[model samples]
Target: MDFNLGTCFYILANYKGYRMSVEECEIELRDYDGEFLRRDVKTEGSIQPEHEVRENCKGCKRKIKLMDEGCVFGCCRVCCSGITKKISSFIGGKVRCCDVHNDRIIKKPTKSVKKPIKKEYVKRICIYKSLSQIIYTGHGADELLAGYGRHRTAYLKGGYKEVTKVLKNEVGRLWERNLGRDDRCISSGGKEARFIFLEDGFVEFIQSLDVTFIADFELGQGVGDKRILRRYAEELGLKECGNLVKRAMQFGSRIGKVVGGEKGDEEFEKSEKFKPPTTDPTKYDKDYRFDITLPDWLPYLQTHGYCVISSAVSSQNTNLALKSLITSLKLLHGNDVDTWDIPEHGLISETLGQSSGAWLIRGSSIVKSAFERIWEEKDLIVSMDCVIIWLSWLNNSNFKPRSEGLHLDQNPFNKLDMISVQGMIPLIDVTEEIGGLQIIPGSHVGVLKEEFKDMHGDMRGKGDWCQAKEEYVEGRGGEARLVECKAGDLILWDSRTVHGGKVGSLGGRREGVEDGEIARASVTVAMVPRAWASEEVLEERKEGFRIGATFNHSPHETGTSTGTVKGKLYEDYIPIELTAEQRELL
Candidate 1:
């Protein structure tokens, strides 16, 4: 047998587990060869058992798949389903929120920190820009592999697991509403503008994944999930109501198609921008109050990028990035990990880009020093009332040097500044987590009540403003609307209008905070018309107030202030000061 015609089977075949005819065994061997070829397809470009294979992701050309000990090929490693399983197995902790973040952080000195550059030219456009949205699958990054929170919940509820579909839809919806907000705000020259929409909804064609949804949402349910969202709000100290739900506005508005469905109707009603709900403001009266502000000083503010408000429309991405920043900064501080600092001053960081209510007051310190001169001296020269009254007529953009603070002295670049009006400058940041200020609109132009009527002198956040709201602001606790803005957002309002920051709601934002918390953060400045000053001082103040609004102070609010000029002009001119009777006409 060894020499002559030894069958290829040899002798061990009779001893093997299965004893079959020679022909049958040949077929069985063919089957094994086929099986091997199938298993090897994932490793090699072709499934020939003899070819060499490489490690890579099956779906992508170059992305390497996450491999297990024995699985080195893309077939078993790169798919999201596999990735999700691995992540779940690794992290078994509880995630309490879908809308809130709680990582406090401190900013570490970057090896090379780039300063904000002063602009050479200012671009002004009308506030009639239309905004659009792009809705992509947040689920792919959001829910697919690891974040099966809602899907996981769906599995528990009715066993009809549609996690991927729901989230993809949700992401689309959020984009829609976000675009709406951008449209309305920027249409009024607020710098929250949009130019396009993008979407990805092909996932439904993939296998539907099932999981337990983590969020048991009972929205508009006064206090149910409110606490979860508020807990993070507490860390941040949100001044406005916690509309945490805006996170999904992009998905809701764009790719979900459901949001797409609603958008047609939303776009049809032009007047809906300012119309109030039939009910009251307190009672969840509407979807979102799209109060498009026609800045009282349209022509004046137009010299800078006043009308160019760009909403990132990537709110979730921006917020999560903030969480990461907060966490990373805290780690660097060597402080309690959960405790972080949020800069309550400096408002420029509110908006992520270089536009609108936020502007970089950085460059030559000489320029900064000059700017600070405007800061400490503004109110004394420009009657705060006159400045307030004039904001309605000017470009009403950043209004740098709106107010002074601790950091006012530390900005190594030019002295940074911020300004806001009764309404808020909301921003949707995509870069980091820290967000901007909040304010109550229409708090201005309203008179104080019987009780507060006696206290109408100095303060910005309290005193007479509170008294006015107690009586007039029906539904918003007082008679005022809040400006819930995102980062990179600069808010401007009438000076008489009452505004304040809700404690910091964004975690990683301010550099010093671990779990970000503080007052409404901003680099504030108020711009006043030269008319507010005495004729003698007006010449000097005019240089700073109206000049270079186009280039020197791009984001705006570069006001003129001469502390020395104030008292000196009052002395030399001897103009009759306005008494109560004379003030009424003004």
Candidate 2:
């Protein structure tokens, strides 16, 4: 073949080990500046190029590696060293050539010689090389294309409509369930991944297609799922690939077998790493009461099943009551105390209930006034049977008081005509952060009773006290609300309302002195109109007051008292003097 110098250079650079006969050729080589290095050379030869053609250096007559000096268009660098600017302008591309040295010229070319190419060109080549290292994942395809066995199950059960619904939900949550996790795993290796099926435009196109067209369950297995995609693959001559069966990545790689065992035999026991540390129940048993703006008590109570009366006892009276109780406790249990160690049901010693301190709290004119307003009746009798005291020490200890479960003080099987109400007086500010009482509002309006019956067998008249199921309290329209109060405030609830106590950390305290101080202190009391009680119940109430006995919350019942105080007795306990109004409670 007859060829010019440029054709010869191209053939020599690209087609290695090729032998061709060049009958005649006009050889012309130039510097980048177009200055002629050689012109109109004639040749006839059978040329067999072993590798790259090496040119002889004009200065030393030694053959050099092709473009080893970063020369432009294969020009001899030693002979044209001073023509860099001219050569650069002629090439019209960035060219960096090495400095020529007389001592470093190669006497004989070797196969190990490499060209010094421009850095920008090498960077471009590296970018193309990186493309080959990428991993392409078929992540979002399965979600959008009905590729799972579950999808086949859905199709069999409900046809295209079910499959379409499943696909929509899967695609909607793909980013949350799969894409994010897969991307994190792949990129953790300093590599990258691409999800071609998840591209926004491609996803939208697939979603726009009719479900029947996208998949055909009747076609069976491999051909049944992703029917449209398989057909398109076949059209592209990927017949074998198109016919391949689908396999989950975990199953295909056998990772599931190694990591989690057989599909149906996977064990999902709770991990100890996620278990919560055991908390000291006594640490949160302390009491709190804070003064807040009072709402209209009767109306609010009627609407919400409970209401808080701010300053139900005067601050001075509250402090006196607290001091009296503390003094009684000191007299009975000594001064250095960690907890009152009261009954878990929150019923304190009957002796403590009848102590001068308890009488002072029960006789507070403010408390009576609040109760009178609530019942709209002047003649009221207090439940002298049960004086519940929640007294906890500041020391962090595990002494839990009162079951946290919601319960009713009155039996639902009984007549609903009684107007009895229960109350609590906090000795410190009670806030959400320092948890206290929780109540379900409006739960006393007969609706909760029906729900309770549905959940538990009808136990009408079976018992007077019943703890509500947690599910009933947490279900729709049954969420409980916290009742926070300040010192001396009165929190009252209907006997039928669902309510419970919640212990909380006392939270902030001064560094040194207050660290082991009182964490929580509160008193529970209840009252009802005297007319609601029978003569026998009235006699029992009077006898209870005489013997310093404690009872539960019912003012009209005779047998509700916890009988005589059982544990630890104070023989010399003296009762506090009561006013005429307090005297009527007996």
Candidate 3:
């Protein structure tokens, strides 16, 4: 290995007092960083010399893994991952326990604890040792030798080139893959890590090795198939860890097994049981749904024509919309089930279409940001259209049995270009029971669009019904993914996307929702650029605003011009003032 002056200085400084031989220095310097002493800790158990035992997991009595997992730790994978808990009653109690035990306690609820609980919330300062200080040698040896399973597989399949690619990726993404998680996990215990593997000279030396000698698992003139460092271990007579296959610390310690270990194919299939038929643009695994927090949104949207922005709108806005909608519903129906019926076609004209509270959805910053991203401009107009409050009981009665609203929102003959994008913002959590929006991904592309163009004139007649034919949707190589949105989550889809409101609840009953309860609750908004707005369209918007009318979602096609028809306006029009942004939207 070619050591520059800086590296040589590091080696000399570290080994100076020991008066070590060059061979000894090489072996020692390979794993030693300035943070660690030239020694190993012999202490065991969860806590060490400097570290204090803050608390043990109530489930297994082991030190907690994630800091966020509260004192009453639920040991199940669901609880560990911060998803919904299986038990209902143990939710608010201070008793910390694993999910398995918690479920057991809840199931056998006959034994209620009547004793007054005494608990102390202590504020203690604890200094935990870093993983780097505790496990430096293992991390260093893994980097130097082909210890990772991926390294072995890559070497076996594509030889040196692929192995080198893997190494580069590992090093580059070390922070994202390992260091970041480790840092957070360790820091939760009030500790910091120092990586000897990240030492400049050591990393350079590891990278400069002959790729074949390092990774190729064949008996060679260079070294044996696996663990080149094993040869050195033999030389040093330290055989314990020399030939050991790599295992993650969590797995080796059986922490992962205690909870559910990494999900297998069976588990993956179980989780994706509800994944709809959709064209896979990224070719991601069937189990891979686009995580809302990840930055890979733009590409995903471009490919899928729909993307969910999780936790986009505030709960405050959601609550406001929900209250307004319920209040308006009370005013219109007054607890009368008979009056809550829609037309036989399952279409309700002007259903919660003109409430002043509908402005909450249109003015949402999160919704506006999403619209800007879609249109690539802030100067966009919001459509004063369908902010539906779909009561499953009402719509389900007259609707044709087994009929799904799988249709594109955009009229084909009207305009070739995409003139609008629609946003669906739910006021309440959209459980599978509260059947909501669903879509066929990437069906908006190429031949599907061409096929849809042929039916434009028929589709736009009257109220403009555009349902996806079974031959087109089912026969086509795409799946209809039932979109489940949480309250405050913003869902955006292209106008050409084949989407519709699901008929029945997607699955189980929603929590706290009783039989025949209000099912789907959502508000829809259409966004079009201000530049697309015409004089007639503006005038129509003004008139619609005045009379609390359910204005058209898109600019209405009248002859060769876009304008609102006078007959569509409500009789009792109460004119409302429009904000600057709302005016531009007209």
Best by lDDT: 2
Candidate 2 on 549-585: residue-level lDDT in tens? 6666677875452222344444554556676646866
Worst 10 residues of 3 by lDDT: 118-127
User: Regarding TM-score, does 1 or 3 come out ahead?
Assistant: 3
Clashes of each: 103, 18, 10
Cα lDDT over the full model 3: 0.51
- 231 Cα displacement, candidate 1 (Å): 54
What are the lDDT figures for the candidates, one per model?
0.27, 0.58, 0.51
Off by over 4 Å in 1: 1-436, 446-451, 454-482, 505-521, 525-586
Task: Quote the positional error of residue 443 for candidate 2 in Å.
Answer: 0.7
Please, what are the lDDT tens digits per residue for candidate 1 over residues 194-244? 232232343342224332222322211112232343444556877355433
By summed lDDT, which 10 consecutive residues of candidate 1 come out lowest? 385-394
